[model samples]
Target: MLTKTEVVIGMTFLVLALLAISVLAVLASTCLVYPIAIDYFGIDQLTGLSRGELIKNYSVLMAYLTRPWVNDLVMPYFRASREGLIHFAEVRRLLLFSQLVAISCLAFTGFWLKRLQGLGQLHHLKRWLLNTCAILLAFCGLIACDFSRAFILFHRLFFQNNYWIFDPRFDPVILALPQGFFAWCAGLAVFYLLGQLILLYIFSIYKEGQAL
Candidate 1:
């Protein structure tokens, strides 16, 4: 039978491995998306397309890109595709997939921690896990912000042809600002949750130690 400490450590390793695998999978999917997009949609389509058009194109690309067979080979190739070598869709897909994987990993980690708490063995691990989660969340938020800024800049510089149709000027002012603002809010929420978890862990440890 696995001791509590062993279980905790095993689960931690599992979660980390899954997270890493998911990140790699996402990156690979993204690489495939780019070339396929460039081929089907064309550079002009990518640069000059409206947001709606881009989304529609992306959906179509993802449909084909994420097939089981393709995904298997595409992932590592994406990692290999350095700066200018890869397609935009490849990068985009990777980012999208990575976020999804991260979210899933975090959720699973939380679920496991909850189980540990129920078993009365989570006190020591919870603090460290919550702090790690908070840091990861903050990093994710920063990445999201960077992507948003890059997307906007890419559109402004390259896709400025359809000025009237693709105008994001007003959208940025009203909606995009809030979107950026909420990312910070999300980071803070993660930080707060980490603090709460740490407190809970401390209380648990104290209570358990007292009972001994």
Candidate 2:
């Protein structure tokens, strides 16, 4: 009963859903591991010490603190380390909650795509969905590249001598700019995608009436 164009659109939606789910998993893992690794490795304490002291005795601290290994390996360890611990439990709870929200969003989007496919309206889906997806993928890729640069820039601006810890006021403002920009872009993309889906639904209804 489905046409070739509808089938292609459905397949594309399914693929995008799968890819978004995978990205959610990766982000969740990263969020879980980063803090734990910082604590376990004592990166903050190490970095807090004078360079002379680090050079003289804790040379390994430089490698441990500055290396990409913390981002990749240590973060997950930090996430697992908090289990059964009373201290910093609130932070862990919040992290888990945040991850849940992100995963839930991805899951819901995937469900919507599935619903659209089931409605057999793929062929007439708005052009905006494809454009939005493409833009989102590109935006994410750009942010990934920018992340490293931002880290270095922040370090140079604020952390060259001081150990960067959570400062509620400045930290939130500094973090908000990049996150807010990305969120706005992603929101627009999702809006466009949803609009396309709506158009597809209308087209399907029109076609059905014509056949009747």
Name the 10 consecutive residues with the lowest summed lDDT in model 1.
Answer: 76-85
Q: What TM-score does candidate 2 get on C-alpha atoms?
A: 0.30
**What TM-score does model 1 achieve against the real structure?**
0.34
Question: How high is each candidate's TM-score?
Answer: 0.34, 0.30
lDDT by residue for model 1 over 1-212, one digit each (tens)?
A: 33768666646643554454444454444444444444444533425545444445545444544444334222211121222223334534544565566666667766665665666664556555565667767766676668566445545664433331222332221221123333443444444444554565676676667646
- Report, for all candidates in order, the number of backbone clashes: 4, 4
Candidate RMSDs in order: 12.6, 13.9
Worst 10 residues of 2 by lDDT: 75-84
Could you give candidate 2's per-residue lDDT for residues 1-212 as a string of tens digits? 55677556655554455444443443434333434434545544644533233233222322233333432222211222222122123323433454455466557655655565567644444444465557756765675667556545644663333333333243321221233333433444444445544555576566546645
Model 2 residue 210 lDDT score: 60
Deviation in Å, model 2, residue 124 alpha carbon? 5.3
Best by TM-score: 1
Query: Candidate 2, residue 26: CA error in Å?
Result: 1.9
